[model samples]
Target: MLVGSPKVRMPPGPRGPAALNTLRLVQRPVESMIGWRRRYGDIFTVRLLVFGTGVYVSDLDEIKAMFTGDQSSLRAGEANAPLAPVLGSRSVLILDGPEHLRQRRLLLPPFQGSAVERFREVIAEVAEAEVARWSVGDRFRMRDRMRELTFEVIVRAVFGVTDPARIERLRSALVAVIDSQAVLLVPGALRRDLGGVGPWAAFQRRKRAADALLYEEIEHRRRDDDLGERSDVLSLLLRARDEDGRPLSDAELRDELMTLLLAGHETTATSLAFAFDLLPRHPRVLARLRDELAGGGADYLGAVVSETMRIRPVLDAAERTLTEPRTVCGWDLPAGIRVYPAILAVQHRPDLYPEPGRFRPERFLAEDPPPYAWIPFGGGIRRCIGAALAQAEMAEVIRTVVERVDLEPVRPEPEPVVIRGITMVPRHGTPVRVARITG
Candidate 1:
C-alpha cells in the first residue's frame, strides 16, 4: 500500500490546490514560479489540480541529477503522455532507451557538424527573401511572421521544398495542428486524458494530409535508389540504418519527420519571437547587441539567441519520474512521483545570476553556465537532436533581420508568455513596426 504522506514533512510549497497553481504557472510560468521559489526556496512539491502531481526544483545539484539521470530511472514518456496522440505513438521525443538512442543517431548528422554548414546558405537566402517581402511601413504581428519565416526555413532546409505554392499548403496544415495543441495545455484530466478528440481528430486529419505529401517525397527518393541525392534531413533519415542494418519503417519515418517539423519549427520560432520582443524594451542591451553583430557577425547574434532562450526558455520545465524511491533536495520522493526542474526558475535565480531578469548575451559568451542553469534545448540522453541546427537557424535569421530592416517596438502593452502544451509562446502575438533600411 502507498503511504498517505512521507514520514518526514514535505518541503514547504504554496498552499491550496496544487493543480490550479500549476495551471497558473503554465499561464505565467516564469514570473510566478520564480516567486514560488523565492517564497518556498529551491525544492518543493505541489499537488496539481486533482490527480496531477508536480515537484519543482531550482536546486542545482538536484536538477543536475534530474537531467543527467539514468534513462530508465527518469522516463519522460510516462510523464508526457498527453503529447503522444498528436506527436504519434512512434515519435522520437516519446521513445526511450535503445530506441531513443537509435532515432537520435539517425537524426543527428543532418543537424550538427559539417552537415549544418551545408545548409547555411539556404537558411540565409530564405531569411533574406522573406525580409524583402516585408513592406517598410507595415505593422505585422512579429510572432506570426517569425513563425512563418522560420517555418519556411525549416521546410526548405530540412525537406528541400522551395516551391511557394506547395510550401504554403504545408504551412497551413502544420499551423492548424500547432494551434490545436495550444488549446490542450490547460491542466485537467478531462482534457488531458481524452486528447481533445473533436479538434484533435481534425488536427490529425490535417496531419495525415501533410504526411501524404511528406511520404510521397520519401517514396519518390526511395524509388530512385540514388543514395547520393542532395542533402536534407529526409535524405539523411532515408539512408540511416540501425545496427541491424534495417531502414526506418514508413510509420517511423512519418513520426520522426512530424517530430522534426513540429519541434524544429515552433520552438525556434517562439525563441526568435521572444528575442525580438525583448530587443526593443532593453535599449542598452539592444544597442550592444547591434554593436556585437557589427563587429562579430552572426556568432554575436547566436549568443543573443542563447541568452534569450535561457531567460525565457521556450519550455518552462522538462519532467521526469523517479523509478526508485529517492531523497531529492531533502524530501523523500517515492517511486513514480514526477519531478519538474523549472528551467525558468533556475535561470532567473539572482543567487545564481546577477540581475537575472535583464537580457544579457554576455552570460553565454565565454564560460559555460552552471549545469541545469541553462537548458533551453534540454540535456543528457534526451537532449534535443536539433540544438545546433536551431542555433544556426536563429543566428542566420537575426543577422538577416538586422542587416535588412530595423525593427522598432510599437507603443503597445508587452505580452505575457504562456505555455501551450510543451512549447511556450507569447500570450498575445508580439506586435512591432518595421522600417526598411535597405530595400
Candidate 2:
C-alpha cells in the first residue's frame, strides 16, 4: 500500500462536541457507527465523547497491523491510560511487555484446565437460581437481573462465598460508581463550574471503599495459605508464584481480582442482555439458533455465543497507538496518533459480512468467517484474557436458560446505552418476561 500524507482528511462523518456525537452513539453505538461506515470507507475519524480524536478502523489489515506491533511501536497501556483511575496501574488489561506477559501468565490457569471446568456447575447453578426468581408473565429488567446474577456468580466463584448482604451492598455500590460517565481530560474547572464536582468526588470515595474491601479479601487469603479448600480465582491467584517462587503480592492479587470481577461480569451481562433482546425480535434467526442449540447442546451454544458477539457486540472498540510513523489501508498516519479497531464496525462491514445487520449465527461456523473478521474477545497479544472462561460460563448459562425458561422481550426492542465509566450497558435496562419451557 502506498503511504499517503500526515494531513490526510478524516473520512467524512458527524462533528461536534465529543459529548454530542458520543451521546448519539451511546444511545445506539452500533447503529451510529454502521451509518458512518455507509458514508465513510473502512476508516473514519470521530471527535466524540471522550477526549481527543477516535479513529475508527474496520479494515482487517489495519486492525492486524495495530494489534501485532511492538510495544515501543504500539502500546495498549498508553492508549488506555484514561482507565488508570478505575482499573488501577497494576491491571493486566492495560499493562505492556514483560509486566503484561507476567500478569497474563499468572492469570491463565484459573480460566483454563480443571479450574474453569469446575466453574461450569456453579455458573449453571447461579443461572438457575436467578431464573427461579423470575415469574412467568411478569415484566422485569433483563440487564438489571443479569447484571446481579453475573456479579453474584463472580463473587461466589472468586470469593468462595455468596453472602447475599455483602453481594447486594457491593452491587449497589458498583452501580452507583459505574453509572457515572466521566470523559477523560474533561477539565476539573469546567465540571466544578457546572456543579458536577461533588458526584465525581463521591465516585472516587465509593471506588476506594470497593478497593478497600477487595484488598481486605486479598490480605485474608494471603495470611491463610490453605488453597485446597478454596477453588476461587482469588485463592488461585494468591497462591500463584513467579519463577523466583514468590506468591503474588497483596496489590497484584487485588488488581487481578478486581479486573476479573469487573471485566467478567459487565461484558457478559451486556452480551446476554443483547442476545435475549435480539432473539425474539428476529424470530426466524432465533428459531434457527434455538434449534441448533437443542440439537448440539454445548457445542451449538458456543457457536451461538460467538455469532451473537459478531452481530450485537458488547464492546465497540479497543485502542492502540502507532509505534512508528506508518501507512495503513493506503492512508498515512503519524506516530502518537491512536487507532481504534472497531469490533462491531468490522463485524458489520458488508465486505466481511453479507446482510450485516441480520442476526446470523451460521456466519461463525468453522467454514464461515475470514481470519480476524469476527472478534468479540479480540485477537493477537491483546485479546481478552478471560475469553475461554467467559465462553465456558456463557455456554453453561445459555444452556441452562434455554433448557429451563422461555423468555420474551418486555420492550419492543433493546436500546444499548453507554454506561461509560469503563464499559457500556443499555440506557434504561433491557427488560423482558419469562415463562418455563414446557414439556
RMSD of 2: 4.0
Model 1 per-residue lDDT tens digits across residues 299-381: 55767888888788888777777677778887877776778877878889997778998788877777777777787777777
Cα lDDT tens digits, model 2, 350-386, are 8788898777776666576877787777767778877
RMSD (Å) of each candidate, 1 decimal: 3.4, 4.0
For model 2, the superposed segments whose C-alpha errors exceed 4 Å read: 1-20, 163-201, 285-296, 366-368, 413-424, 435-439
What's the residue-level lDDT of 231 in candidate 1? 89
Full-model lDDT for every candidate: 0.76, 0.72
Model 1: CA > 4 A from native: 1-9, 182-204, 436-439
Considering every candidate listed, which one attains the maximal TM-score?
1
Count of steric clashes across candidates, in order:
3, 1
